[model samples]
Target: MFFRSSKINEFRLWGLLFTLAGMGLMILGTSGIVFWGQAGKIFAGIFMVIGMIAMLISVGVYFWAGMMSTSATMLTCPECSRQTKMLGKTDRCMYCKTILTLDPGQATQHPADTTQT
Candidate 1:
């Protein structure tokens, strides 16, 4: 669960970083020709293409994250007693640090005991 949350947070951060970088590149590319010479134009074209690709990839990542978020199961944390969501074979309560596992045979398993309350 800790790993999953970390991964999700990392993905979110990367997506944001890529988005900002792409926007900056786009602005630089468009302004370069006005400030510099023909060399600027060449660099601008290259930067624009790379920036557009980065932006597109970020959009794809956002969509993928949305899908995963929807598929995750909701639960209440036993430790924190707060509503949270879980995903995959193992997960953590979003509101608490409790390690949650859906597998019944595992020693660390927490039952899918709670419904909405």
Candidate 2:
């Protein structure tokens, strides 16, 4: 419950974060010369290499997520009446964040259907 995002969305979010981090690292590397003069070139090269590795990782993540999304089940959300993708037996609506499940055994009662005295 701590993370309520859909599986595909979570992967995309991580990929985006890695991409931004890689760009930031590359920028920082180029700016190293401004801070350390001649010796900063070495630091710049190291940072740039690390940034490239991060960018590669981000690309891999995006590709993996894309493949998974294509195989995921597409269904209409009962609460929001919107088409959403599900990664597993249970998932949440992308737009409305409503909890959904495909298992009939678990559908006897919904979390949102509690009655109070």
Candidate 3:
């Protein structure tokens, strides 16, 4: 395995948060809570556009997170001895904060690959 999958879930959480925020903004825009003049209409339209963009971004993030989660490998951390999912080439034990790698060949690899995913 490369790195832990909770990272993917992190992205998923952020996506949900953004989706909710976007929906809230959309509702606020439609309610015209900012103002009542013609400028309010313009602001509302802008808000709606921005909210839509945020929702789209959230969707993309959710998709990416799902894909990553699928590829992630589950393993027991030697340090913590607990089950953890890994993402990239190297990752720290999510519980005990112990750095770990699934590939023995990577044990002596370059410093760049040692980065926690």
Candidate 4:
């Protein structure tokens, strides 16, 4: 059946937060050098590296989500007759609470493949 869009949205939100946090850390690290001397410079360098890595990972995840979103197929919910996109083998209608499945065999065979059941 349908799963909550909140999970994917949450991941995207967290990725954004990480990206912003990384940028802020990088800036703070660079700015510290003017007043803090060698120690500040070293700390700033460390922050910069960590921040860059975090931002890179976030960017990669965002890109992946984008690709998945694009590949998701749009369908009408039989339960509510509302339209929504299906990701993977199963997904829920955004407007309806009905559990939708893309694969009929999954519902009959696995029964527990919630994605398709």
Q: Where is model 1 more than 4 Å wrong at Cα?
A: 1-8, 28-31, 107-117
Question: How would you encode candidate 3's per-residue C-alpha lDDT over 2-105 as one tens digit per residue?
Answer: 34434655687789988998999898887774557666787789889989998999999999987887788888987668987777877666577666677778
Candidate 4 least-lDDT 10 residues: 1-10
Q: Report the error of model 2 at residue 76, Å.
A: 0.2
For model 4, the local distance difference test gives 0.75
Model 4, residue 26: C-alpha shift (Å):
2.0
Please give, for residues 18-97, the per-residue lDDT of candidate 1 as tens digits: 89989999898988888888878998998899899989888887777677777777777778888776767666666555
TM-score of 4: 0.62
**What's the C-alpha lDDT at position 55 in model 3?**
97
Whole-model lDDT per candidate: 0.74, 0.89, 0.77, 0.75
Count: clashes, candidate 4: 3
Worst 10 residues of 2 by lDDT: 105-114
Sorting all predicted structures by lDDT, with the top scorer first, yields 2, 3, 4, 1
lDDT of 2 by residue, 33-93 (tens): 8999999999999999999999999999999999999999999998889999998888788
Q: Give the best candidate by TM-score.
A: 2
Q: What is the lDDT of residue 41 in candidate 2?
A: 97
| Model 1 pairs whose backbones collide | none
Q: After superposition, how far is residue 71 of candidate 2 from its true place, in Å?
A: 0.3
